[model samples]
Target: MSRLTITLDDQLHRALKETAARQRRSIGSIIEESLRLRGIRTYDSAMEIVSKARAAAGLEPDEALELAVREVRQLRREKKT
Candidate 1:
Protein backbone atom coordinates (compact mmCIF):
# COMPACT_ATOMS: atom_id res chain seq x y z
CA MET A 1 0.00 0.00 0.00
CA SER A 2 1.03 3.58 -0.60
CA ARG A 3 1.07 6.27 2.04
CA LEU A 4 -0.10 9.79 1.40
CA THR A 5 0.84 12.84 3.45
CA ILE A 6 -1.75 15.61 3.49
CA THR A 7 -1.89 18.78 5.52
CA LEU A 8 -5.31 19.37 7.03
CA ASP A 9 -6.34 22.51 8.84
CA ASP A 10 -6.68 22.24 12.61
CA GLN A 11 -10.44 21.97 12.67
CA LEU A 12 -10.58 19.39 9.88
CA HIS A 13 -7.80 17.42 11.52
CA ARG A 14 -9.63 17.42 14.83
CA ALA A 15 -12.85 16.35 13.14
CA LEU A 16 -11.17 13.43 11.46
CA LYS A 17 -9.64 12.36 14.73
CA GLU A 18 -12.96 12.56 16.49
CA THR A 19 -14.69 10.58 13.73
CA ALA A 20 -12.03 7.90 13.89
CA ALA A 21 -12.34 7.64 17.66
CA ARG A 22 -16.13 7.40 17.45
CA GLN A 23 -16.06 4.75 14.73
CA ARG A 24 -13.16 2.78 16.23
CA ARG A 25 -11.25 3.01 12.96
CA SER A 26 -7.88 4.30 11.96
CA ILE A 27 -7.82 7.85 10.57
CA GLY A 28 -6.53 6.47 7.28
CA SER A 29 -9.58 4.23 6.79
CA ILE A 30 -11.91 7.11 7.49
CA ILE A 31 -10.07 9.30 5.02
CA GLU A 32 -10.16 6.55 2.40
CA GLU A 33 -13.90 6.07 2.73
CA SER A 34 -14.54 9.80 2.62
CA LEU A 35 -12.49 10.14 -0.52
CA ARG A 36 -14.37 7.26 -2.09
CA LEU A 37 -17.82 8.76 -1.38
CA ARG A 38 -17.14 12.49 -1.74
CA GLY A 39 -18.44 12.58 -5.38
CA ILE A 40 -15.37 14.46 -6.62
CA ARG A 41 -13.72 11.48 -8.26
CA THR A 42 -9.99 12.12 -8.50
CA TYR A 43 -8.68 8.81 -7.24
CA ASP A 44 -7.80 6.05 -9.76
CA SER A 45 -10.42 3.63 -8.45
CA ALA A 46 -13.05 6.34 -8.61
CA MET A 47 -11.91 7.49 -12.04
CA GLU A 48 -12.14 3.97 -13.44
CA ILE A 49 -15.90 4.28 -13.88
CA VAL A 50 -15.40 7.38 -15.99
CA SER A 51 -12.54 5.74 -17.81
CA LYS A 52 -14.75 2.84 -18.82
CA ALA A 53 -17.36 5.26 -20.06
CA ARG A 54 -14.79 7.12 -22.13
CA ALA A 55 -13.65 3.87 -23.68
CA ALA A 56 -17.19 2.91 -24.53
CA ALA A 57 -17.72 6.31 -26.12
CA GLY A 58 -14.32 6.19 -27.87
CA LEU A 59 -13.05 9.28 -26.05
CA GLU A 60 -9.61 10.03 -24.73
CA PRO A 61 -9.25 10.67 -20.99
CA ASP A 62 -8.77 14.41 -21.45
CA GLU A 63 -11.77 14.57 -23.77
CA ALA A 64 -13.81 12.56 -21.30
CA LEU A 65 -12.89 14.89 -18.47
CA GLU A 66 -13.90 17.93 -20.52
CA LEU A 67 -17.16 16.33 -21.50
CA ALA A 68 -17.86 15.43 -17.89
CA VAL A 69 -17.29 19.06 -16.88
CA ARG A 70 -19.66 20.27 -19.54
CA GLU A 71 -22.29 17.74 -18.48
CA VAL A 72 -21.99 18.88 -14.86
CA ARG A 73 -22.42 22.50 -15.90
CA GLN A 74 -25.46 21.58 -17.96
CA LEU A 75 -26.93 19.70 -15.01
CA ARG A 76 -26.40 22.69 -12.72
CA ARG A 77 -28.14 24.97 -15.22
CA GLU A 78 -31.04 22.57 -15.47
CA LYS A 79 -31.23 22.39 -11.68
CA LYS A 80 -31.40 26.18 -11.37
CA THR A 81 -34.31 26.26 -13.78
Candidate 2:
Protein backbone atom coordinates (compact mmCIF):
# COMPACT_ATOMS: atom_id res chain seq x y z
CA MET A 1 0.00 0.00 0.00
CA SER A 2 1.01 3.61 -0.61
CA ARG A 3 0.05 6.99 0.76
CA LEU A 4 -0.33 10.13 -1.31
CA THR A 5 -0.90 13.69 -0.11
CA ILE A 6 -1.99 16.27 -2.64
CA THR A 7 -3.13 19.85 -2.58
CA LEU A 8 -5.97 21.20 -4.65
CA ASP A 9 -7.67 24.56 -4.99
CA ASP A 10 -11.04 25.04 -3.26
CA GLN A 11 -13.11 24.54 -6.39
CA LEU A 12 -11.28 21.45 -7.52
CA HIS A 13 -11.44 19.95 -4.06
CA ARG A 14 -15.17 20.59 -3.87
CA ALA A 15 -15.63 19.06 -7.34
CA LEU A 16 -13.71 15.95 -6.43
CA LYS A 17 -15.67 15.52 -3.23
CA GLU A 18 -18.95 15.99 -5.05
CA THR A 19 -17.98 13.43 -7.66
CA ALA A 20 -17.05 10.98 -4.93
CA ALA A 21 -20.40 11.51 -3.18
CA ARG A 22 -22.37 11.06 -6.42
CA GLN A 23 -20.54 7.85 -7.20
CA ARG A 24 -20.97 6.55 -3.62
CA ARG A 25 -17.20 6.36 -3.31
CA SER A 26 -14.43 8.03 -1.37
CA ILE A 27 -12.56 11.13 -2.51
CA GLY A 28 -9.50 8.93 -2.73
CA SER A 29 -11.32 6.67 -5.16
CA ILE A 30 -12.21 9.65 -7.35
CA ILE A 31 -8.56 10.64 -7.54
CA GLU A 32 -7.61 7.07 -8.37
CA GLU A 33 -10.19 6.92 -11.14
CA SER A 34 -8.88 10.21 -12.56
CA LEU A 35 -5.41 8.69 -12.74
CA ARG A 36 -6.74 5.61 -14.54
CA LEU A 37 -8.53 7.77 -17.11
CA ARG A 38 -5.31 9.69 -17.74
CA GLY A 39 -3.32 6.49 -18.04
CA ILE A 40 -5.47 5.50 -21.02
CA ARG A 41 -3.75 8.32 -22.94
CA THR A 42 -0.52 6.33 -22.76
CA TYR A 43 -2.13 3.38 -24.51
CA ASP A 44 -3.59 5.68 -27.18
CA SER A 45 -0.16 7.19 -27.81
CA ALA A 46 1.48 3.79 -27.98
CA MET A 47 -1.01 2.59 -30.58
CA GLU A 48 -0.42 5.75 -32.64
CA ILE A 49 3.31 5.14 -32.48
CA VAL A 50 2.86 1.52 -33.50
CA SER A 51 0.85 2.51 -36.57
CA LYS A 52 3.40 5.15 -37.58
CA ALA A 53 6.30 2.80 -37.01
CA ARG A 54 4.59 0.09 -39.00
CA ALA A 55 4.15 2.44 -41.92
CA ALA A 56 7.74 3.66 -41.75
CA ALA A 57 8.89 0.07 -41.44
CA GLY A 58 6.87 -0.94 -44.57
CA LEU A 59 3.76 -2.49 -43.03
CA GLU A 60 0.47 -1.40 -44.59
CA PRO A 61 -2.31 0.20 -42.52
CA ASP A 62 -4.71 -2.72 -42.90
CA GLU A 63 -1.96 -5.18 -42.09
CA ALA A 64 -1.00 -3.29 -38.92
CA LEU A 65 -4.62 -2.97 -37.79
CA GLU A 66 -5.25 -6.65 -38.42
CA LEU A 67 -2.16 -7.68 -36.50
CA ALA A 68 -3.08 -5.45 -33.56
CA VAL A 69 -6.64 -6.80 -33.36
CA ARG A 70 -5.48 -10.39 -33.68
CA GLU A 71 -2.91 -9.98 -30.93
CA VAL A 72 -5.44 -8.32 -28.62
CA ARG A 73 -8.01 -11.07 -29.16
CA GLN A 74 -5.35 -13.74 -28.61
CA LEU A 75 -4.32 -12.10 -25.35
CA ARG A 76 -7.93 -11.96 -24.12
CA ARG A 77 -8.40 -15.63 -24.91
CA GLU A 78 -5.19 -16.58 -23.12
CA LYS A 79 -6.17 -14.62 -20.01
CA LYS A 80 -9.52 -16.45 -19.70
CA THR A 81 -7.88 -19.54 -18.27
Candidate 3:
Protein backbone atom coordinates (compact mmCIF):
# COMPACT_ATOMS: atom_id res chain seq x y z
CA MET A 1 0.00 0.00 0.00
CA SER A 2 1.09 3.56 -0.70
CA ARG A 3 0.31 6.80 1.03
CA LEU A 4 -0.53 10.09 -0.66
CA THR A 5 -0.88 13.57 0.78
CA ILE A 6 -3.17 16.05 -0.98
CA THR A 7 -3.88 19.62 -0.01
CA LEU A 8 -7.53 20.53 -0.05
CA ASP A 9 -9.24 23.78 0.81
CA ASP A 10 -10.74 23.94 4.29
CA GLN A 11 -14.32 23.62 3.06
CA LEU A 12 -13.59 20.75 0.74
CA HIS A 13 -11.53 18.98 3.34
CA ARG A 14 -14.33 19.30 5.88
CA ALA A 15 -16.87 18.00 3.40
CA LEU A 16 -14.69 15.03 2.53
CA LYS A 17 -14.17 14.18 6.18
CA GLU A 18 -17.87 14.41 6.90
CA THR A 19 -18.75 12.29 3.87
CA ALA A 20 -16.26 9.65 4.93
CA ALA A 21 -17.66 9.53 8.45
CA ARG A 22 -21.23 9.32 7.15
CA GLN A 23 -20.41 6.55 4.70
CA ARG A 24 -18.34 4.62 7.25
CA ARG A 25 -15.45 4.53 4.74
CA SER A 26 -11.93 5.86 4.82
CA ILE A 27 -11.15 9.17 3.12
CA GLY A 28 -8.74 7.34 0.83
CA SER A 29 -11.50 5.01 -0.28
CA ILE A 30 -13.82 7.92 -1.09
CA ILE A 31 -11.10 9.64 -3.09
CA GLU A 32 -10.22 6.40 -4.89
CA GLU A 33 -13.87 5.85 -5.78
CA SER A 34 -14.11 9.41 -7.11
CA LEU A 35 -11.02 8.86 -9.26
CA ARG A 36 -12.42 5.63 -10.67
CA LEU A 37 -15.73 7.34 -11.47
CA ARG A 38 -13.81 10.01 -13.40
CA GLY A 39 -12.16 7.32 -15.59
CA ILE A 40 -8.62 7.55 -14.28
CA ARG A 41 -7.41 4.15 -15.49
CA THR A 42 -4.23 2.80 -17.03
CA TYR A 43 -4.19 1.49 -20.62
CA ASP A 44 -3.61 -2.11 -19.51
CA SER A 45 -6.47 -1.93 -16.99
CA ALA A 46 -8.79 -0.45 -19.61
CA MET A 47 -7.81 -3.09 -22.17
CA GLU A 48 -8.50 -5.86 -19.68
CA ILE A 49 -11.95 -4.43 -19.02
CA VAL A 50 -12.66 -4.24 -22.74
CA SER A 51 -11.39 -7.75 -23.30
CA LYS A 52 -13.66 -9.12 -20.60
CA ALA A 53 -16.68 -7.27 -21.98
CA ARG A 54 -15.95 -8.40 -25.51
CA ALA A 55 -15.68 -12.01 -24.40
CA ALA A 56 -18.89 -11.78 -22.37
CA ALA A 57 -20.79 -10.32 -25.32
CA GLY A 58 -19.15 -12.69 -27.83
CA LEU A 59 -18.38 -9.73 -30.07
CA GLU A 60 -15.83 -9.72 -32.89
CA PRO A 61 -13.21 -6.96 -32.95
CA ASP A 62 -15.03 -4.82 -35.51
CA GLU A 63 -18.39 -5.27 -33.83
CA ALA A 64 -16.90 -4.34 -30.45
CA LEU A 65 -15.28 -1.25 -31.94
CA GLU A 66 -18.55 -0.14 -33.52
CA LEU A 67 -20.49 -0.69 -30.30
CA ALA A 68 -17.88 1.17 -28.31
CA VAL A 69 -18.09 4.15 -30.69
CA ARG A 70 -21.86 4.26 -30.48
CA GLU A 71 -21.81 4.01 -26.68
CA VAL A 72 -19.26 6.82 -26.43
CA ARG A 73 -21.32 9.05 -28.70
CA GLN A 74 -24.46 8.38 -26.69
CA LEU A 75 -22.65 9.15 -23.43
CA ARG A 76 -21.36 12.42 -24.90
CA ARG A 77 -24.86 13.45 -25.95
CA GLU A 78 -26.23 12.62 -22.52
CA LYS A 79 -23.44 14.49 -20.79
CA LYS A 80 -24.18 17.61 -22.85
CA THR A 81 -27.68 17.83 -21.44
Candidate 4:
Protein backbone atom coordinates (compact mmCIF):
# COMPACT_ATOMS: atom_id res chain seq x y z
CA MET A 1 0.00 0.00 0.00
CA SER A 2 1.06 3.57 -0.69
CA ARG A 3 1.67 6.06 2.11
CA LEU A 4 0.03 9.47 2.12
CA THR A 5 1.20 12.58 3.97
CA ILE A 6 -1.54 15.16 4.35
CA THR A 7 -2.30 17.89 6.82
CA LEU A 8 -5.56 18.57 8.66
CA ASP A 9 -6.92 21.51 10.63
CA ASP A 10 -6.71 21.42 14.42
CA GLN A 11 -10.37 20.61 15.00
CA LEU A 12 -10.53 18.03 12.22
CA HIS A 13 -7.30 16.40 13.35
CA ARG A 14 -8.53 16.21 16.95
CA ALA A 15 -11.82 14.71 15.80
CA LEU A 16 -10.00 12.07 13.75
CA LYS A 17 -7.84 11.15 16.73
CA GLU A 18 -10.88 10.92 18.99
CA THR A 19 -12.78 8.81 16.47
CA ALA A 20 -9.85 6.41 16.05
CA ALA A 21 -9.54 6.06 19.81
CA ARG A 22 -13.28 5.54 20.27
CA GLN A 23 -13.40 2.90 17.54
CA ARG A 24 -10.23 1.18 18.78
CA ARG A 25 -8.74 1.49 15.33
CA SER A 26 -5.51 2.96 14.00
CA ILE A 27 -5.44 6.53 12.67
CA GLY A 28 -4.51 5.14 9.26
CA SER A 29 -7.61 2.97 9.15
CA ILE A 30 -9.81 5.87 10.23
CA ILE A 31 -8.31 8.11 7.59
CA GLU A 32 -8.75 5.38 4.94
CA GLU A 33 -12.41 4.95 5.77
CA SER A 34 -12.99 8.72 5.79
CA LEU A 35 -11.29 9.10 2.42
CA ARG A 36 -13.31 6.24 0.95
CA LEU A 37 -16.58 7.81 2.14
CA ARG A 38 -15.56 11.30 1.01
CA GLY A 39 -14.77 9.96 -2.47
CA ILE A 40 -18.37 8.75 -2.72
CA ARG A 41 -19.89 12.15 -3.43
CA THR A 42 -23.57 13.15 -3.65
CA TYR A 43 -25.60 11.65 -6.51
CA ASP A 44 -23.24 8.74 -7.16
CA SER A 45 -26.09 7.00 -9.03
CA ALA A 46 -28.77 8.14 -11.47
CA MET A 47 -31.56 7.58 -8.92
CA GLU A 48 -29.63 9.58 -6.33
CA ILE A 49 -29.31 12.49 -8.76
CA VAL A 50 -33.00 12.34 -9.54
CA SER A 51 -33.85 12.29 -5.82
CA LYS A 52 -31.73 15.35 -5.23
CA ALA A 53 -33.42 17.19 -8.08
CA ARG A 54 -36.84 16.33 -6.75
CA ALA A 55 -35.90 17.58 -3.30
CA ALA A 56 -34.60 20.84 -4.74
CA ALA A 57 -37.93 21.36 -6.50
CA GLY A 58 -39.73 20.97 -3.16
CA LEU A 59 -41.73 17.97 -4.34
CA GLU A 60 -43.24 15.67 -1.71
CA PRO A 61 -43.02 11.89 -1.96
CA ASP A 62 -46.41 11.42 -3.64
CA GLU A 63 -45.87 14.35 -6.00
CA ALA A 64 -42.46 13.10 -7.03
CA LEU A 65 -43.84 9.62 -7.63
CA GLU A 66 -46.64 11.04 -9.76
CA LEU A 67 -44.18 13.11 -11.80
CA ALA A 68 -41.98 10.06 -12.41
CA VAL A 69 -44.98 7.94 -13.38
CA ARG A 70 -46.20 10.60 -15.77
CA GLU A 71 -42.80 10.84 -17.41
CA VAL A 72 -42.59 7.08 -17.80
CA ARG A 73 -46.07 6.93 -19.30
CA GLN A 74 -45.21 9.72 -21.73
CA LEU A 75 -42.05 7.91 -22.76
CA ARG A 76 -43.99 4.70 -23.36
CA ARG A 77 -46.53 6.55 -25.49
CA GLU A 78 -43.75 8.09 -27.59
CA LYS A 79 -42.05 4.73 -27.95
CA LYS A 80 -45.28 3.18 -29.31
CA THR A 81 -45.26 5.59 -32.31
Candidate 5:
Protein backbone atom coordinates (compact mmCIF):
# COMPACT_ATOMS: atom_id res chain seq x y z
CA MET A 1 0.00 0.00 0.00
CA SER A 2 1.12 3.53 -0.72
CA ARG A 3 0.16 6.89 0.69
CA LEU A 4 0.13 10.38 -0.78
CA THR A 5 0.20 13.77 0.89
CA ILE A 6 -2.50 16.07 -0.43
CA THR A 7 -4.04 19.38 0.55
CA LEU A 8 -7.78 19.95 0.17
CA ASP A 9 -9.78 23.14 0.44
CA ASP A 10 -12.63 23.66 2.92
CA GLN A 11 -15.49 22.37 0.80
CA LEU A 12 -13.56 19.52 -0.72
CA HIS A 13 -12.22 18.47 2.65
CA ARG A 14 -15.73 18.42 4.13
CA ALA A 15 -17.00 16.50 1.10
CA LEU A 16 -14.35 13.85 1.48
CA LYS A 17 -15.05 13.54 5.17
CA GLU A 18 -18.75 13.16 4.46
CA THR A 19 -18.06 10.56 1.78
CA ALA A 20 -15.83 8.59 4.15
CA ALA A 21 -18.45 8.67 6.88
CA ARG A 22 -21.27 7.73 4.56
CA GLN A 23 -19.31 4.79 3.14
CA ARG A 24 -18.12 3.72 6.60
CA ARG A 25 -14.51 4.02 5.44
CA SER A 26 -11.49 6.03 6.34
CA ILE A 27 -10.59 9.25 4.51
CA GLY A 28 -7.49 7.65 2.99
CA SER A 29 -9.54 4.70 1.80
CA ILE A 30 -12.07 7.01 0.18
CA ILE A 31 -9.31 8.91 -1.60
CA GLU A 32 -7.75 5.68 -2.88
CA GLU A 33 -11.10 4.45 -4.16
CA SER A 34 -11.76 7.78 -5.90
CA LEU A 35 -8.32 7.64 -7.54
CA ARG A 36 -8.90 4.07 -8.70
CA LEU A 37 -12.19 5.03 -10.37
CA ARG A 38 -10.63 8.07 -12.11
CA GLY A 39 -7.65 6.01 -13.25
CA ILE A 40 -9.82 4.76 -16.11
CA ARG A 41 -10.01 8.26 -17.62
CA THR A 42 -6.71 7.59 -19.45
CA TYR A 43 -6.63 5.48 -22.62
CA ASP A 44 -4.22 2.90 -21.22
CA SER A 45 -6.13 2.56 -17.98
CA ALA A 46 -9.55 2.47 -19.66
CA MET A 47 -8.23 -0.08 -22.17
CA GLU A 48 -7.57 -2.47 -19.31
CA ILE A 49 -11.19 -2.20 -18.17
CA VAL A 50 -12.26 -2.56 -21.79
CA SER A 51 -10.23 -5.73 -22.15
CA LYS A 52 -11.56 -7.22 -18.93
CA ALA A 53 -15.19 -6.33 -19.58
CA ARG A 54 -14.76 -7.57 -23.17
CA ALA A 55 -13.24 -10.95 -22.39
CA ALA A 56 -15.68 -11.54 -19.58
CA ALA A 57 -18.62 -10.64 -21.85
CA GLY A 58 -17.05 -12.39 -24.94
CA LEU A 59 -17.10 -9.20 -26.97
CA GLU A 60 -14.71 -7.83 -29.60
CA PRO A 61 -12.32 -5.03 -28.59
CA ASP A 62 -14.10 -2.42 -30.71
CA GLU A 63 -17.45 -3.47 -29.30
CA ALA A 64 -16.73 -3.58 -25.58
CA LEU A 65 -16.19 0.01 -24.48
CA GLU A 66 -18.58 1.29 -27.09
CA LEU A 67 -21.23 -1.08 -25.76
CA ALA A 68 -20.72 0.08 -22.20
CA VAL A 69 -20.82 3.76 -23.18
CA ARG A 70 -23.91 3.17 -25.29
CA GLU A 71 -25.72 1.37 -22.52
CA VAL A 72 -24.90 4.13 -20.06
CA ARG A 73 -26.36 6.76 -22.37
CA GLN A 74 -29.35 4.60 -23.15
CA LEU A 75 -30.15 4.25 -19.48
CA ARG A 76 -29.90 7.98 -18.94
CA ARG A 77 -32.04 8.64 -21.99
CA GLU A 78 -34.63 6.14 -20.85
CA LYS A 79 -34.85 7.98 -17.53
CA LYS A 80 -35.56 11.25 -19.34
CA THR A 81 -37.80 9.91 -22.04
Candidate 6:
Protein backbone atom coordinates (compact mmCIF):
# COMPACT_ATOMS: atom_id res chain seq x y z
CA MET A 1 0.00 0.00 0.00
CA SER A 2 1.09 3.59 -0.62
CA ARG A 3 0.44 6.67 1.44
CA LEU A 4 -0.90 9.84 -0.12
CA THR A 5 -1.31 13.32 1.24
CA ILE A 6 -4.13 15.31 -0.26
CA THR A 7 -5.44 18.71 0.73
CA LEU A 8 -9.19 19.11 0.68
CA ASP A 9 -11.43 21.98 1.65
CA ASP A 10 -12.80 21.84 5.21
CA GLN A 11 -16.35 21.11 4.09
CA LEU A 12 -15.29 18.41 1.63
CA HIS A 13 -13.07 16.80 4.22
CA ARG A 14 -15.91 16.73 6.73
CA ALA A 15 -18.25 15.26 4.13
CA LEU A 16 -15.79 12.53 3.22
CA LYS A 17 -15.30 11.59 6.83
CA GLU A 18 -19.01 11.48 7.45
CA THR A 19 -19.64 9.38 4.39
CA ALA A 20 -16.91 6.96 5.34
CA ALA A 21 -18.36 6.57 8.82
CA ARG A 22 -21.84 6.04 7.44
CA GLN A 23 -20.67 3.40 4.97
CA ARG A 24 -18.40 1.72 7.54
CA ARG A 25 -15.48 1.98 5.14
CA SER A 26 -12.15 3.72 5.35
CA ILE A 27 -11.92 7.09 3.63
CA GLY A 28 -9.07 5.79 1.50
CA SER A 29 -11.29 3.01 0.16
CA ILE A 30 -14.04 5.47 -0.71
CA ILE A 31 -11.60 7.68 -2.55
CA GLU A 32 -10.18 4.65 -4.40
CA GLU A 33 -13.63 3.53 -5.47
CA SER A 34 -14.42 7.04 -6.71
CA LEU A 35 -11.24 7.09 -8.77
CA ARG A 36 -11.95 3.67 -10.30
CA LEU A 37 -15.54 4.69 -11.13
CA ARG A 38 -14.15 7.73 -12.93
CA GLY A 39 -12.00 5.48 -15.17
CA ILE A 40 -8.67 6.42 -13.60
CA ARG A 41 -6.97 3.04 -14.00
CA THR A 42 -3.35 2.05 -13.80
CA TYR A 43 -1.76 0.74 -17.00
CA ASP A 44 -1.60 -2.87 -15.84
CA SER A 45 -5.18 -2.84 -14.61
CA ALA A 46 -6.42 -1.33 -17.89
CA MET A 47 -4.55 -4.00 -19.85
CA GLU A 48 -6.04 -6.72 -17.67
CA ILE A 49 -9.54 -5.45 -18.36
CA VAL A 50 -8.86 -5.28 -22.09
CA SER A 51 -7.46 -8.79 -22.08
CA LYS A 52 -10.52 -10.13 -20.28
CA ALA A 53 -12.90 -8.39 -22.65
CA ARG A 54 -11.04 -9.65 -25.69
CA ALA A 55 -11.09 -13.22 -24.42
CA ALA A 56 -14.78 -13.07 -23.59
CA ALA A 57 -15.70 -11.64 -26.98
CA GLY A 58 -13.25 -13.85 -28.91
CA LEU A 59 -11.90 -10.76 -30.69
CA GLU A 60 -8.61 -10.43 -32.56
CA PRO A 61 -6.11 -8.08 -30.95
CA ASP A 62 -6.62 -5.22 -33.39
CA GLU A 63 -10.39 -5.66 -33.41
CA ALA A 64 -10.46 -5.74 -29.63
CA LEU A 65 -8.36 -2.60 -29.43
CA GLU A 66 -10.67 -0.74 -31.80
CA LEU A 67 -13.80 -1.87 -29.95
CA ALA A 68 -12.34 -0.97 -26.58
CA VAL A 69 -11.42 2.51 -27.79
CA ARG A 70 -14.88 3.12 -29.17
CA GLU A 71 -16.60 1.86 -26.01
CA VAL A 72 -14.39 3.99 -23.78
CA ARG A 73 -15.11 7.08 -25.84
CA GLN A 74 -18.85 6.38 -25.72
CA LEU A 75 -18.67 5.91 -21.96
CA ARG A 76 -16.85 9.22 -21.57
CA ARG A 77 -19.47 10.99 -23.64
CA GLU A 78 -22.27 9.42 -21.59
CA LYS A 79 -20.55 10.45 -18.37
CA LYS A 80 -20.22 14.03 -19.60
CA THR A 81 -23.94 14.16 -20.28
Pick by TM-score: which candidate is best? 6
Give candidate 6's total backbone clashes: 0
User: Root-mean-square deviation of each candidate, in angstroms?
Assistant: 5.3, 10.1, 3.9, 14.7, 5.5, 2.7
How many residue pairs collide in each prediction? 0, 0, 0, 0, 0, 0
Stretches of model 3 off by over 4 angstroms after superposition: 49-81
In terms of lDDT, the poorest run of 10 residues in model 1 is: 34-43
What residue pairs clash in candidate 3, if any at all?
none
lDDT of 3 by residue, 1-81 (tens): 899999999999999999999999999999998776555677887567567668889998777767765665676566556
| lDDT of candidate 1 at residue 42, scale 0 to 100 | 55
The number of clashing residue pairs in model 1 is: 0
Candidate order (lDDT): 6, 3, 1, 5, 2, 4
Candidate 5 stretches greater than 4 Å from native: 40-81
Q: If both were scored by TM-score, which would come out higher, candidate 3 or candidate 5?
A: 3
Could you arrange the candidates by TM-score from highest to lowest?
Answer: 6, 3, 1, 2, 5, 4
Residue 37, candidate 3: alpha-carbon lDDT: 58
Per-residue lDDT over 9-80 for candidate 5, one digit per residue giving the tens place of the 0 to 100 score = 999999988988998999987776665544325677657768878989999877898976776567556655
- Pull out the clashing pairs in model 6: none
The deviation in Å at residue 64 for candidate 3 is 8.8
Q: Note the Cα lDDT for every prediction shown.
A: 0.77, 0.73, 0.79, 0.71, 0.75, 0.87
Ten contiguous residues minimizing lDDT sum, candidate 5: 33-42
Clashing pairs in 1: none
lDDT of 4: 0.71
Candidate 2, lDDT over the whole model: 0.73
User: Candidate 2, which segments miss by more than 4 Å at Cα?
Assistant: 40-81
Question: What does the lDDT read for residue 19 in candidate 5?
Answer: 85
* lDDT score, candidate 3, position 9: 100
For candidate 5, list the clashing residue pairs, or say none: none
